[model samples]
Target: MSETPTHTRVREQMNLSNAVYEAIDTPTASGEHAHKVILRDCLGTLAVALENSYKFGCASDATHSRMLGHFAQNGLTTNNITYAPYPEYRAYARNIRRTKPKLYSAPDAALAEVFAAYGDIARATWDTQGNPEPDSRHAVHVTALAAPYALREYPDLDASLVSSYSLVHDILEWHAGDTPTLNLSTQGHVEKETKEAEALELFCTTFSPEYPKLVTLVTDYEELVNDEAKYVKTFDKLDPGFTHFGNKGKAIKELGIDSPETFWREHHNTYVRMSRYALDFPRILEDRDTRAQMIEELAWPSAQ
Candidate 1:
């Protein structure tokens, strides 16, 4: 049978969406060309695509609109996506794989290498997306480290399983780089998920022999078929919010989110996504909101 109207519209949307990624994958030009200029081009492509997709009445029209709202309210000039230094991490992984024999003989050295690789992968700042400072900025390893501490509240869950899921949940980012929850179009999200899966396969084939359990842990976390995965997932969502509130909305201010309207408009999408966790971890959800309230009411001087 011929394609349905829905399929045709979605195909068109995908073409537009793919263009956004194509613009990103394009190399920066030589000589005095600012890299930020490339991001402008990418967003411009994304804007046209989203506008057309919304007009076609795609299922994600609201999501598309909110994404644009996020950029608009937060400041159109903002650079949200950051990438890790290319080939550097790839080289490091290769080096680790080469020395796997020696590392295998010395368990401490092997573990250290794993932690070191993870330590180099940075988390996103409150304002932007991607992994900019893999060496210095917010490290994702902190989320793994904090998992056990957060486990105290959920006393009945399997601590060992939770810990395992946390440690490996973001391991693929060592190669894939961190993709923020809010920064991408639906197609952009799909491309990121594909890239991350490819990275995970690389890890399993190259490094899993040395770190055998890694494949299981990463896969289980992705599948999220157990309480352990769900528990770890809750922490993953909360970690950034924890950092945001702990820093007293410092980054939010840097993004010029001085008003409640701007702050909520930018954050409303994330808050709605986080609300689901209330089913499994009510306290975690409550903590997120309580802290958010403080930021909205007290952190913004103009709001106060």
Candidate 2:
């Protein structure tokens, strides 16, 4: 079989990379306290996205073949080019299907399967009768789908970045436990508090020297919280009367915190810096301009 054309390979790799980053950047839940239902929804969304990427690859290959045919007709290449490597592309497509087999089996089947698994995990975790660990099968499926995309995009990325990203996915799955219960309480104070605390812990521990800029950005955020008299008010000014501290007002209300300051102190890392970090993954991977904008946003307060 002939190898895939260089252009096809490049496009496949680009799409895969974009998809992987999107998966990472998209939020999920963790632990016994997460909402299994929403977690299932998120997984379903990811599975569909992966499938779409496969279809996109197929279409891209067809387009490229037609273009190549035109080139040959015009005598661009004397050799008659045959596009036979379409099957090779299936390796990546197969992994996506394999990861979410039940979902891909039929229309809406995968979503139902994901929901069932999510329900099982959520019930088990919330009941407190047994360990409510995330569904291993679902976790495996997510990682398998994610790995190929990651490898294709940042082929040269340090193995550790890949590992770290996988771990991030795991954390999101675990957090899914909290999603179901998020809106149950009308006040939403407890949920917001819990998320803020969780986000803070995640932010501080996840940063490393390999991504020094990320670390620096987080550090600056910490400084803002620590010297809130100066920075908290400044952030508030950014959205006047909006209260930009401690998971912001909305997250604070969702997590159920009395004051943004309290939320900031307890979960400053995740709520402020880490949340932003997670959201930044796609921008950093897909668009240089977005990355620059992010860095500026993260560093703005500190620079002042």
Candidate 3:
């Protein structure tokens, strides 16, 4: 196994807080604040690592570009120095998998060992996509720790992209299952239904005075979906909040008018509004006076 890198050690320290785990489990108005703190700490460490790498000139720009290309190919990001087309990178990755099967094969190795290797690759890939100059030692250590599970589950998949996607999904999943009003009538489905109901309720109540505007936003989103317009391009550029609130608005429209409520109840958890609000709420709360005013505003019933 590759020696764990020092930066990876630092990252582990950054992410090792029990408070983060506890905060994730507990839902409160302050949950967003907790998440931001964690994200800021993690990203800050990464930034430091990148700066160190730059100072040392250990890794070349070409290497960084290649790593970024790998990320972009995997639907991770498109902001790399190369800015290589995603499809091209995807094709290259596919070709490499097909042509160099030995690079991924683990003949005669224990399943655990193979899995560990895969997890390491996934972690490296995640860091590469997230930042070109991730703390080298830290990234290596993280990848080493994470590789085994990823390899065990998806021997053929790109472990890094899969890991990245999983991280994003897990963050989004936390907002589910809190409110009983949103819980689906159906049994055995994911608990996202409950979360969706809560979000819809929040949007309706919080923006009640703006119902006409909400309806219009929903209508536009539905139209864009039906017409198969680009997902990010379908909404008004003036207010991204409307676009976010309209997450899955296209899917909801397909259910037909008679079943709007039923459709919303069923798929509310799948919408992006809650996730966006959760992420953005921290920034909104950063201003001490503004946060105080918001607390006051939110304390009152929606009718007010």
Candidate 4:
């Protein structure tokens, strides 16, 4: 018997994820070159996984098959190409079925705008330092992709609102791009902030009347106002941290970060900055502790 389309899609999605999962373990020579190769491979794997998961969730069987075929053909060619679902697939999937309507409303114009704005915005991480074309997923999509898993720890929070917050938390960054400003001077920070603020104002004015809650969620996320928004913010930090950890901190180690304290304090400062929020929500705190211990163990495995 032939496999059903749903089964085919599930298998393909797992294949995409497992390809990266296995690639991560392949040994390589140690050096800057090796780190660059590892970073590139990891980012590529993440991009494939994120895109595959999204297409599997939304695309019609025919559309997905076409996409899969295109990707497979490209894999056979020497011409450099990145696999991506067509825009028509996304627009057509506007009416697709959703398990959580609140978190994912069908035929939502505001949500459509959010998705379009973030479609190609590559996130800036330590791993993507000098690459002209980093295969990184956008923060907007990251939030939506991570919502189901992240919300499991915070059962008390409103999943809908928190998921909504995750969807739009980085909506303001739509126009400005995800430029890492860690070493930027005060004036530079002010300029970037101003640009982002203008972008937010424009977004809110365009969609606020129709999507007041979404706009409010974006505002709350920027201000760290409420528990739901704060949770999304924390998850934002953890999402990338998890990516780094999955890649075995190659990016961090390449940046000369050798200790857990430095990793927590410098690169992924999610826990350091949001520890206060964890105090108010012990589940968040517990999750932090668990992850922190994992990082510590990863850093000093001999001690374990």
Ranking by lDDT: 1, 4, 2, 3
lDDT of 4 by residue, 98-134 (tens): 3211222232455454455453355544332333212
Model 3 clash count equals 15
How well does each candidate superpose onto the true structure, as a TM-score?
0.53, 0.25, 0.20, 0.51
Q: Residue-wise lDDT of candidate 2 within 1-304, one digit each (tens)?
A: 1233444543443343333222322333443222343334433433333344434233222222332233333333212121122333234333333332223422155334534544454311111122322443223223323333334433343222232222123232233343422223534557645764565455445534223333333344434332211222122111111112212233334344444344335333323433433332332223322322332333243442
Identify the runs in model 3 with alpha carbons over 4 angstroms from their true place.
Answer: 1-147, 173-191, 194-304
Candidate lDDT (C-alpha), each? 0.45, 0.32, 0.27, 0.44
Ranking by TM-score: 1, 4, 2, 3
Cα-lDDT of candidate 2: 0.32
Judging by TM-score, tell me the better candidate of 2 and 3: 2
Off by over 4 Å in 1: 1-104, 107-115, 126-151, 182-184, 245-247, 253-258, 271-278
- Give lDDT tens digits, candidate 3, residues 163-244: 2222221111122322222232345243455554454454345433523332223333323332211111211111111111
Better of 1 and 3 by lDDT: 1
Model 2 residue-pair collision total = 31
The CA lDDT at 107 in model 4 is: 27
Candidate 2 — which residues are off by over 4 angstroms? 1-120, 123-134, 164-176, 180-275, 278-280, 283-304
User: Could you tell which candidate, 1 or 4, scores higher by lDDT?
Assistant: 1
Looking at model 4, which ten-residue stretch has the lowest summed lDDT?
76-85
